[model samples]
Target: MSDERSYPTGIGTSTTDRIQLLGLDLADEVLGKVSFGELAYWLATKRRPTPGQLRVFEAALVSLADHGYTPTAIAARMTYYSAPESIQGAIASGLLGGGSRFLGVTEDTGQFLAASIAALGDTSGYSEDDWDAVARDVLEKAKSEGRKVPGLGHPVHKQGDPRTPVMFQIAREAEVFGPHLSLFEAIGRVHPEVLGRTLPLNGAGVAGASLADAGLPLGLLRGFALLARTAGLIGHLAEEQQHPVGPAIYAEVDRNATYVPPAP
Candidate 1:
C-alpha cells in the first residue's frame, strides 16, 4: 500500500488562500457609516483630538491653503489648462514640484542649529549668552561657506513673513516646544544681525517646525505642504480659465545664429 495520503492540490493552496485574503469580513464595517470629518478625526487620533486641538489643526490647514502662484501652482495651472479633463493629473504635476527645498525648511533649519549646538556644546540652552554664542558661531560658519541660514529671509515678504509669528503662537498655545522651535527662535535672534535687517519666519519654516514638533515624519512634511498648496493651485486654474495667458512666452530667439550642416 502507498504510504502517502491523497490530498487535494488546490484545497490548502489557491482556494483557501484567496478566501483568507479577501476583505469581505470588513465590508459591513465600512458601509456608509462615516462622514469625511468623522473619518478624518478617526484617522488622525484613532479617536478624536479635543475641540481645541481640532481648531488648531484646522487653522494650520487654512493658513497654509494658498500663497499665490508659486512654481508648483503655475505648473498645476498650466497642466490643468492643457488637460482640463484630468484634474488629478494637473495636481500630480504640481505635487511633483513640491519637496523639502520648496515648502519645508525645518529639516535644514534643524540641521543647521543642531550642527551649531554640537559645535558649541553645553551652550545651546535657553540662556541668552549661550544662544548668542551659538548664533554667532553658526553665522560665522554660514558666512564663510557663503550660505544663507535656511529659515530666515523671504524674497517677496520684505518686512517679515506674517505667517511666522502665528505659527509660533500656535505652537506655544499647543504647549509643544522642541528642538525645532528652539532653532527657529535662535535663528530669529541672529537673523537681523546676519542679514543687516530683521528676518521673519516664513510659512515653510513654521510649517516644517510645527510638523516636526508634532512628531510627524520629515518625508510627510512635503506632502502636507503640497496638499496645502493645492487650494491655491485650484484657484489659479479657475482664474486661468477665465483669463488665459495664451501660449507659453519664451525668451527672444537668436536669429543671427549660424546653422551647422548635417553629417553626410
Candidate 2:
C-alpha cells in the first residue's frame, strides 16, 4: 500500500480554496495603511531597526544600487530608450539584465558554507585548523575542475571588494558573526599560499554569511540579495529616461538579402 495520503480529486479542488484566499488578508493590512516610505522601512527592518541599523542598511543599498551600466542596468536603459512610452517595459528590460548572477553568488556561498558545516558535524565546533582543512579540500576540488572559488574574487575590485569589509563590520556590530565568517577568514589565510595570490572576500560572501548567521532560512538568502539589487535597477531606469534612445536606430536594419538567388 502507498504510505502517502491522497486528496479528494473533484470539482472542489478546481475551485479557489478559502484558506488560500485568506493569505491575501495580509495585503489589506499593508496596502494604503502605511505610507510608501514607512512600508519600505518596515520591509527592510522587519520591525523598525534602530536609527543606526537603518543608516547602515541605507548605505549598503545606495552603494549597491548602481555600478555604472552593468549588463542589467544597460539593458534596462536601452529598453527604456526604445520604449519610452512604457515605463514598465523599460524597468523590466533593465531588471532582466541586472539580476543575472548577483543572488546566485550569495545563495551558492551560503550552500557551500552549509555543506562545510554539515560535513564537520557536531564535533565541538570548527577550530581554525578544522576550517583550514575544509578550505583545502574545497580548493583542491575547484582546482581539479579549473573553477575559481566562488566568494573570493571580483572583476572590478582587484585589491579587495570595498563593500565586503563594510558588510562584515555591520554583521560584527550586530553580534551575529558565526562559523561562516571564521570559515571565510580561514579561506583567506590559505588562499594566498595555495593560489599564489591574495583572495579577498567579496560582498556576496559577507552578505550570504551574514544572512545565514542571522538565523534566516537558507532559501531566503537569494531573495534578500535580489531585493538589495533592485535599487540599482531603479537608478538605471531613471538614467535611461533622462537620455532616451529611440526605436529609429533599430528600425534601420535591413530585413531583405542584398543578392538574388542564382537558380530556384
Candidate 3:
C-alpha cells in the first residue's frame, strides 16, 4: 500500500510565489478583471457566465441584498447592541434568522417551482396555456395540503412586490428566462383563480427563479440568498455604528414586554 494521497480542486490554490483561483492568477488576472457577481457565478458553476447571465445573477443578488428593518436586520442590530466587539457574531446572528418565513422563501419557491416543472417530463413543447395549467395544478395541490404557496404572497407588499417585475424584466432582457421563470410567471397569472385572491409573486421568490434559470445548482439557491443578505447585514451593522438604533430597539421591546400567569 502507498501512503500517498492527492487532493484536487479547481477553485483556488496557493503556491510559494503566487495564488491561483480557477486556474488563473489571483493577483494579475482575476484581481480587477472580474466583477464580484461574475466571480460568484463562476465560482459556483466552475464556468464563467456570459454577459447576459451575469446581469440576471447580479440582479438577483441586488434584489435580496436588503429590506429595511427586517427581522434579520433587527436581530443583527440587537446582537450588535449587546456585543459590539463581535461584528462577525452580529452578522451571524442576522444570518441565523434566515428560515422558511424570512429569507428562506427564495429556496422554497425555487424548489417548489423546480419540482413542479420536473414532474412534467417533456416541457419542451409546453405553451403559455400549458404552463398556466401546470401552475394551476401546483397551486391546487398546495392549497389542498393546507400549505401556503411560497412566493405567491407578501406580508408587506399587499398589492405587489416592486422587485418582482424588475427582476422579470432583467431576466427577460438577459434571455435566460427558462422554464423556472416561465412557470413562476404562469403561477402569478393563474394563482388568483386557484387561491381565490391574487397575491404578488414576491422578490425573494423571483430571485430564486431567476437564479435557477441562470444555471446555478438547486441546493445552493438558499446559499445565494444568504450571500446577498450578508451584504445587507453588513450595511445594517455599519448604520448601527453611526446612528445606534439597536439599543433603542432593545429598550422599546423590553419596555413593552408584559408577563401573564401560566395556566395549570
Top TM-score: which candidate number? 3
Instruction: Report the candidate with higher TM-score, 1 versus 3.
Output: 3
Candidate with better lDDT, 2 vs 3:
3
Displacement of residue 98 (Cα, Å) in model 2 is 5.2
lDDT of 3 by residue, 1-264 (tens): 999999988899998999999989999999999999999999999999988899999999999999999999999999999999999999999999999988899999889889998868878788999999988899899999998878888889999999999999999999998999999999999998988998899999999999999998888989999999999999999999999998788788899999888998
Scored by CA lDDT, what does every candidate get? 0.62, 0.62, 0.92
Better of 1 and 2 by TM-score: 2
lDDT of 2 by residue, 151-222 (tens): 788767788888887776876676666777667767777887677788678777666766666555576656
How far off is residue 47 in model 1, in Å? 10
TM value for model 3: 0.96
User: Candidate 3: which stretches are off by over 4 Å?
Assistant: 261-264
lDDT of 1 by residue, 1-264 (tens): 989997743212234334311222223443465434334433543554454444444455556677776777777777776788888888788778765556655455545545555544443256755566567767777888998887776778867788888877877787665566666677778767765778667767766666555544454555556666677777777776787642342112235456899999
Q: Quantify how close model 3 is to the true structure by its C-alpha RMSD in Å.
A: 1.4
lDDT of model number 1: 0.62
Off by over 4 Å in 1: 1-58, 99-101, 104-107, 110-125, 195-197, 238-264
Model 1, residue 166: C-alpha shift (Å): 0.8
